[model samples]
Target: MTQVAELPASAAEARDHVHALMATCPRPCGEDALTDALLIISELVTNAERHGGGMTGFRARVTEDHFDVTVEDASPAHPTLPGERPAGSVGGYGWHLVRRLATSVAVTPTARGKSIHVGLRLR
Candidate 1:
């Protein structure tokens, strides 16, 4: 199934929406993949709110083999991860985690902003 939500000021709101989407999945989603998906949603939405100048849209698509997520924000700046996270650093870790959790990630620059597309394996 597919689900979409307007990007909200609060990351928690976005997180809840993603959870609702996952709950509607036609097939059973494993705990590990589900957890990873939720964390990815939280990180992307939070990043959009904090650095992308707020989120514009969010979407998710689920299939037998994989789940896809796309997040849009108001800034044209694409997200990037550091070569390596410094030990003991608390922040600036979201993008790195997202990369590791997602099987594939793409950044597309839009007219007014950018969209981050992430694909996660379901199995």
Candidate 2:
């Protein structure tokens, strides 16, 4: 079974919510893994806010070997991985970071919006 939580656009609040939920996992998840998970959550939530037409909320689910985090918003357009980052690009690396940290990622259209889910393995 997995646990779930809904969160708003605030990155800090989303991170805190993820931390609290991850703490309940049966197998221990290291600090680094937790940090990565939170960072990915932040990226997803931020993207939803900045581009997804405003975030409806987010969900966090923990399984035996991974933490599944999903963020949903009002837009159907999914996030894309930028091919390259301009020399001094101030932003636009969220999806790239997520791809690096997560074991797997899935973006699917929902009834009302879209959900970007990242799976972070427990180590």
Candidate 3:
């Protein structure tokens, strides 16, 4: 399994970790997939810190067909799609982007928080 000894403190660190791992994976994802994966990582981590209390853990791994990332945060609330708002909304698009880019997304609840697992198909 692809693993990290120390959990990353921020989205950049998490993306760096995944980028390095992708280099070693037998089937690396495409450039567009890489960009999408990074954005997914960033949105999830930022959401954890900004809305879900704070991030508690993070992990990224590559399988034969998918690049997977999981972000754990200190909240039980499941993420929701952005509801109707002003015509020119500044934010709340992150979750939607994640859902669109990821091949699959799952949320698991824990005693203290929740973990969001997002997977992107590899080329």
Candidate 4:
């Protein structure tokens, strides 16, 4: 699958887009992989919305073995994984979780803002 579009800053809207993409994805994805993908997508979108000052663009690509997701936001501040939080911390988990789940992740800073790219291997 290959598609790109602008997404609202809202997590709910981002989730809706993820679900629709999954439904029509070119290859059948295992439930577990899809769930993981959803979680990663949610966190990325949420981070873009909450920390990046709102999402400006979203793109997703799925292949037989992996999926790639990219999110662009309006803030130039690059995202960073917070230092180890105390156990049971209430927040600061999004970037960490993305790093844990994705096979590879990258953040690119642009003149206008930044973009996050995550690649997850299918189960």
RMSD list, candidates in order: 2.5, 2.2, 2.1, 2.5
- Cα lDDT tens digits, model 1, 1-123, are 666656555778766776777777778888898899989989998899888988888877777668888999899987766655566655887898999999999999988799999999888
Q: Write the per-residue lDDT of candidate 3 for residues 19-106, one digit (tens) a residue.
A: 7877776766688878887889899999999889999888788776678888999999887676854666668888999999999999
Encode model 2's per-residue lDDT on 1-123: one tens digit a residue.
457676654988888888888888888788898889888988888888888898886778887678988788899986765666556657777888999999999888999898887888887
Candidate 1 stretches with Cα past 4 Å from truth are: 84-90
Candidate 1 weakest ten by summed lDDT: 1-10
Compared with the true structure, all predictions reach lDDT values of: 0.83, 0.83, 0.84, 0.80
True lDDT of residue 38, candidate 3: 84
Worst 10 residues of 3 by lDDT: 1-10
Q: Give the alpha carbon lDDT tens digit for every residue of 34-102 in model 4.
A: 888889988988888777888888888776678789999899887665676566656787888889989
Q: What's the number of clashes in each of the models?
A: 0, 0, 0, 0
Residue 91 lDDT (model 1): 80
Candidate 3 clashes: the total is 0
At residue 117, give the lDDT of candidate 1.
Answer: 96
Error of 3 at 13 (Å): 1.0
Instruction: Give the Å shift of residue 45 in candidate 4.
Output: 1.1
